[model samples]
Target: MPASSLSPYTLNNGTPTPTAAHSQPGTEVELQPYTGGDSEREVPAQATDRSERPRHIFSKHRKWMTVYMVSIGGAFSALSSNIYFPAIDTISKDLGVSATDVGFTITVYMIIQGIAPSLYGSISDSRGRRIAFVTALVVYLAANVSLAFTSDLAMLVVLRGLQAAGSAATISISTGVIADIAEPDERAGFMGTNAGIRMIGQAIGPVIGGLLNSAWGFRSIFWFLSVFSALVLLGLLIFLPETQRTIAGNGDVPLRGLYKPWSYYFKLPKEWRNAPVPPAPKLEKLSWRTIVEPLTYVLRMDILVLLSWGALVYTIWSMVTSSTTTVLLKTFPDLTQWQVGLCFLPNGIGCVFGSVCTGRLMDRAFKRAETRYREEHGLANVNVKSQHDFPIEHARLSLMPYFSVIFIVSMALYGPSYDFNDLRRHFAGNLVASLGLQFIIASTATAIFNINSTILVDCFPDNSAGATATNNLCRCLLGAAGVSVIQPMIAKLKIRNAFLVLTGIAVVFSPLVWVQWRMAEKWRRNRLGA
Candidate 1:
């Protein structure tokens, strides 16, 4: 009988039953051949359906909202760190401390900002995203409000540390949230948008702090931060839905129960006899194990290493820009707080433009490369695309030339000049460096998010939140080191030479980009077996 003409049969339970026509004459009909074109057509349709399914409710309208809220929160948190720059003199006078002591406050704040995110990230994995975020914001709000009344320098440092706890966690979790919702192709775009908004806050933060401190006094800056924190908290509580996928684990299991080991201590009940057991939770307790497991995971994962290194490089570059902003403003005494704010406008514009452009370019590059590989090899296209198609090395390689230019121009601007002529040259050189800085950060950030998120999801496909939380933990630890050391390094080396030294570091590491690009194909093949 012709394959198309044979009727399919079913047993009493509705399972498919096979006849002679469906199998070899001497073989059991239960092992039927899949001979029809309909099966082939249906396979693609099923895949297409899975790929095109509507996103979760949290992902639909509130995705961008959450990004905005977290971005704003990051900006405010960052501003709290540096906004004290313009107010350093005032804070010194009011608190009866020297400039060095006031500066120490900034140093303390940076250290806390760096360390807190890693801890927050691991906590988010077990506590749920909403709880982690809301809890952080509440701590930040309390810190800000308390700061408004404190005149003691030590009190300020302690409060700032608590504030950092909230701010750092929010930024890390924000990235995790973006990872949770966006697909590999679209992740760059969303991450770019998120980074751009955060940059906007960063760009505007110093200006706002300068103005508020200049007009109403230094306490006013904390008040302003408090207001911003409150608003973000309100928005998050109202609009931001939880994105943790683990919460969907069977209704019978409590969140705490999932973490405990049942297999070694207790037997499975009758109903659970055939149910599959989940893998052991990386952290059995929230003690050192929680911290150690994430660190170990970061060390073991190649993609995570690439991302950490990229973030470290990017932060080293950022230190030059951030540390010098205040020093640069010193050259222009006539420049008001408002003017300092305006100077940041160009950096903000460059960041937004660079992020959007790089995101699109990265996506196109990945897609084109994938298409060519499929065509040249004469391989049938599969419905599901492998992560191997996205080569992060190319993304990193593209930024090398730009980074070299940034290093040269930034180093050149450090010389003394005559009158306002010197000021104009300084601003122009700084702007150029700032533009390059934005481009490097935007591109590298996109690459890190795309590669890390893809690999992480693949690694723990069933535990996306946990995987992302661990990823956040790694980046945060490295970022904290970057922020904490930048100021001390700048003080020791001076701005110009400090940047030159960093440039040398960049030069050394830039070759790794090429190394990554050359081996990416082979690495992906071996890693994913595509």
Candidate 2:
């Protein structure tokens, strides 16, 4: 690209933002705000021409409705990823490929899930939300349709990667949409809902896939997914308005589009024709190409800490999920495929409960912290500076250790060290432990993610999409690594010992959670110029 094109758009004073890791190899990836969206809460005073501004439509629709829409988008990513799990053996047999080859599809899918969000996030930041959402869904729908028709294992593997690429963006972009409309205080509840619905999607995929495979075959699962995606895309078109603040200006922007209804053209009054056009997305330089730029956030200490913690959480969460067959089947061998699928119900329900409830709690917690801090400091309750200077890190992380410690304990309870099959031989004893473990782990982990993600978004309010993409990258890559190691760890250590090791890792790092909490506020205040 030409140097002119590679440069960040110069603001009024010709302020230069940091160049990316790509093209300019020696240039470090610093956390610099883009020229236009320097603040999430404030549009720059320089650009406040009323005629050029787009309206914000957030108040026109209900907040919960937006959360529900984005949550389903979040859910689809995991749904696409995990939906293939129970059907791996069936697919292997049907395609005349070895089970190992079929399994490679998952590895590829994880790798794509880890990497693809960068492309989507960067583009959505520079382009527009609706286009990115639509593009991802369209590709995802097409990939599912192709997968449903393909009999070749090779084609299936490739399509699986493409399917993952399309779906992963739903998560990163959903975060962007939330950041666009939600104030820092209410963000917790909204982020919690996203995390919760995402967990629901993740937990249910195996069950849905298993039942579909048992009744209709592996192809039917993909067929259903394609149709489901089509419906979601339609909903996005009809109901989910664009929430990218730079382009749309909050929730009330009345931007003209290429796809307007007949009424738009019918408003051919001479007055309407002379009206000013709403400003489109202010595209800055596109230096952050794909996975490279997002990975650079690892250089920032606060981002590095949260992303590391999130990855470990995902590692533990995926570990429990991967063991579903081993743990559940041993305890319930007589259970049908659908019954085994249904076993995940508690886990899914717990995650949903954790996500939404925690979201609300996050807001309340922040408010309480704000109130308490003001009282202790002898400052007025409405001090904007103190509120701006509030330690969001402490607010988000203060209670995290409790949830995390319990999370580890829950993992241990569900592990296969004892022959729960023989010991908890009665279905009643087995059922309670099985369900209880999932609820504890899923709920606790969901709370941790809700707070963690919301704070991360707070840290980089301007770069919401990029921060989320980096979060996805770190967590998924760690999750992929964790998934690859579980069997070997189990083989060498035994199930109990294996889980003990993983739990021990969590135990050891538990204090680091508080350490991150302590350090996060200083780093955030400094970088954000709070």
lDDT of model 1 at position 97 = 92
- Taking the tens digit of each residue's C-alpha lDDT, what string does model 1 give over 244-316? 4454232122223423323313543343456565553343345666644555545433454455555555465
- Writing each residue's lDDT as its tens digit, candidate 2 over 1-530 gives 44455444334346532333221231111222234553322222222332233222354246678878877977888787667767766788888986557756766787789888888898777776777888889999999999999879789879989999999988888888887776555678779878888877767887898899899999999999999999988877766666676665554445557222234354542433655666664566666464366668788778778877778887788777666655555556676667666767677777888888888877888888878876877655232212346666777776688888889888777665345657655464567666778778888887787777787687666567877888888888888778777766766777677777888888777766876877877765565554
- Name the TM-score of candidate 2: 0.83
RMSD of each: 11.0, 6.8
Full-model lDDT for every candidate? 0.55, 0.71
Report how far residue 354 has shifted in candidate 2, in Å.
1.6
Scanning candidate 1 in windows of ten residues, the lowest lDDT window is 23-32
TM-score for each prediction? 0.70, 0.83
Q: What is the lDDT of residue 132 in candidate 1?
A: 73
Q: Which one is best on TM-score?
A: 2
